[model samples]
Target: VPDITNVQVQINTGAPGYSPLETEQRITFPVETAMAGLPGLQQTRSLSRSGLSQVTVIFKDGTDIFFARQLINERLQVAKEQLPDGVEAVMGPVSTGLGEIFLWTV
Candidate 1:
């Protein structure tokens, strides 16, 4: 398989106790809106939970991962402005399916 060409955005609502609907409206939607129309973007998937929102940005095959991340980083700046105070949207680690070499069971 090819390297995983995707970027993930994690949003932590520092203060807890947020409902799913609130998280979706206040966090997920805005983030999704910010990511729309990104070049080389294939599609985006998101999940809004109690205190967190995860947005996975998938890019088309053959697209450079580094370039994709750079685009995401720039867009995140715009997203930050629309986010609530203390709520930060950060990128997840750089990992690929082939990076998994082994699995250990304890």
Candidate 2:
């Protein structure tokens, strides 16, 4: 199987007690907006929960994952300015669904 070209952006609102709506408004939207217009970007899906926001960026098939991540890394710098103090967005590990080579069951 071929590796999937995708990136996951995780936002951790350091402070707790944030409601889902607030997280969506403050974290998710800004991140999604920052990711807009990226080359080879297929779609972006986001999930906003209390104190956390997860955005998955799916690129077109055959897109270079490294280049995609670089684009995201640069954009995230700009998005940081819009985020609240202490809140930080970090990209998840670079792994695809079929990248795993080991499987174990206990």
Candidate 3:
């Protein structure tokens, strides 16, 4: 496991083209709900809109998507029962182009 700081960012996707991204999403959260433990974390983004929710995942400098996906898949498999039904979660590429220019823009 690599060193990581716990960051949690809650984003509103419906806010005129809001896309999740690094640092912006890694703010802080409950221990179990964090992604630092998953490894190969280049970035993370969580989007909630119109009742739909999603997490955009990114890999680190030396990590590959396949490995990251596998780890995420296995964790989800184990957490299937723990998570509420109807909430579809999967590991997908984070769209940098969709990311915001800055962590915050007043």
Using lDDT as the measure, the top candidate is: 2
lDDT per model vs. reference: 0.76, 0.78, 0.44
The lowest-lDDT stretch of 10 consecutive residues in candidate 3 is: 22-31
My TM-score estimates for the predictions, one after another, are 0.80, 0.81, 0.49
Rank list by lDDT: 2, 1, 3
lDDT (Cα, tens digit) per residue for candidate 3, span 3-99: 3423222222122232333212322121125445677666666544434445555566557546666776665565445444343345434334324
Least accurate 10 contiguous residues by lDDT in model 2: 97-106
Candidate that scores best on TM-score: 2
Candidate 1 regions off by >4 Å?
1-15, 98-106
TM-score of 2: 0.81
Candidate 2: clashing pairs of residues: none
Which tens-of-lDDT digit does each residue in 11-77 have in candidate 2? 3343267788998998889999999998988889888888788888888877777888899899999
Which residue pairs come into collision in candidate 1? none
Model 3, global lDDT: 0.44
lDDT for 47 in candidate 2 is 86
Model 1 poorest ten-residue lDDT run? 6-15
Give per-candidate clash totals. 0, 0, 5
What would the per-residue lDDT of candidate 1 be over residues 12-77, giving only the tens digit for each residue? 333256788888898888988998999988888888888888888877877777888889889989
